[model samples]
Target: MNLGLKTAVAAFALTTMALTAASAETRVTYKSAKTGSSYYQMGVELAEAMKAGTDGDISVTVEESQGSVQNVMEVRARGGDYVFTTPPALVGLAQGGKAMFEGKGDPAFDEIRALFPIPSLTMHFVMSADSGVTDISGLAGKTILLGKGSFGATEGEKYLDLFGLTDQVEIADAELSNAVAALKNGQIDGFVTAGSYPAPNVIEAAASTPVTVLSMSDAQVAETKRTKLTIPAGTYAGQDSDIATTSLPVVAFTTTKMDDDTAYALTKTFWDNKAKLGDTSPWWNGVDPAMLSNIEGKIHPGAVRYYEEAGIALSDAQK
Candidate 1:
């Protein structure tokens, strides 16, 4: 071959190899919560963790989600390398076509499989005004923003009716991202958000304006039948006492469309780098192998491989 021709051919070969390597890189779509929420923040952190953990071999694209219901519903359309976070109870509902998913059942819902637990979805009823009532009843007569189509919104509605505040409190319908600003501007009295404790949006609102995290009493906790959680005093700005609340177990899951190798890598990287992630974000510290029992349906085969090798026990249902 002539010199120029040989050089051109070599360059073409290198370009082809580069494209091939790029194509081999696995790209994932991670759906969690809307922007400004702590769950969304965790999705961002998980994306970063995946990039670092897999040495750039596996990349995650974090997408803004309205709520866990949206995340679960998207499983119908999402196929390859798709992952999302939702409470286990929602997974069961989706499979059974119950609650918000009533009559919306699709065979795709059956493909959803559990990956790993990220953090519990702790309920937060944040208020900037002093309603004089210590528990959630104080929310009565206050305008509270419960963003649409999220676990928080659904739970908030139920809590209002359950605690007898439905008509008493004004509902400010808005996007969750605007909540902190709304509270600070006196546009809304408070908002309900569900994410890990020490939620970023709550902290932001409290720091900007004195805020109260409404607590629930023991009987009220029993009435809700959700897991009880206590945010210790000093957990939030200007909050002098501990706040009692309920939390829903949230787990990351993917469909059968994902390859086992990618699932295994993601799960392994999560537990391996969890401590480092927690150092930067307190929410990650809430995750541990013990929470694996919370996963509903069958655990992903790839995640099962990691848990087995790590000697972590899995509930019979999870196995």
Candidate 2:
């Protein structure tokens, strides 16, 4: 071949190889709850659905994390491409830098962008029936396990503060599975867990021993209006009555580093295959396209464009 023709052909081959590699797969990481937790399971399911919906163009790796607070920090540090977190934690970190972000020397966390809202998490304060604790008031002067460095732990402290029991009760830090084990062995009076109804850890503990899922007092519920939630009747084993408590909205978010095309594609793939995703877990049943724009942190511009194009109005908060 002529020298000029050979050079042009070699450049074209290299460009073809690079384009092939880029189109072959896009690897992304997802930070979720600790292993064996509901949030983690949901992340796995989402990763699967996304891969299938995109025809394997996107591959998501699910990494175990300490739930919302840790996930937020990880996302800020670019530890993962996507994260499962709560709205309150995102708002606190982004707007006021409160809670876990307080005095952490990090500037206000405004770079994270919301993708979509998942299920709402209901806080459960489960006590051993044998502990002689029946309600929130009985937690005083007793040790309670709150998942350390987790969103649950922060909320647990807030509940104690609102009820004037912070000084009276002894606070212990542990993960959910360990906390349940502690409750079973009488090492702790009660432990706080927040997630969708019929949390696996709570169910596993209730099956082995008698457990009391405590309810918040009317006055206490009124004090924290933002987290008001209820555990409906027949939601858990051995629990026949509804328990009024606190709750928070769980959302999926990504950082500003995510490209707009990828973000838009991921968002579209999720909603397009949402029904199939919901079939895998009840947690997805609560996901509403209309609620996508209702999230606290700024919505991803790609997601915003997708929703707007689909005729879904952006809430004032999202705007």
Best by lDDT: 1
- TM-score each candidate: 0.79, 0.73
lDDT string for model 1 (1-319, tens) is: 9999999999999999999999988999999988977778898999998899888998899999888889998888888679999888899999999999999999999888898998898999888765444568677788889999777899999999998989999999789889999888889888999878778889888888888889989999889889877888888888888888998888999988988888899999999999989988987876778777777689988988998999998887776
User: How do the residues 99-139 of candidate 2 rate in per-residue lDDT, one tens digit apiece?
Assistant: 56776635425667788777777788999888889888898
Error of 2 at 92 (Å): 4.9
lDDT value, residue 133 of candidate 1: 48
Scored by TM-score, the top model is 1
Candidate 1 whole-model C-alpha lDDT, 0 to 1: 0.87
Q: Which stretches of candidate 1 lie over 4 Å from their true place?
A: 1-20, 35-37, 127-131, 137-153, 165-191, 208-210, 238-241
Query: Which ten contiguous residues of candidate 2 have the minimum total lDDT?
Result: 79-88
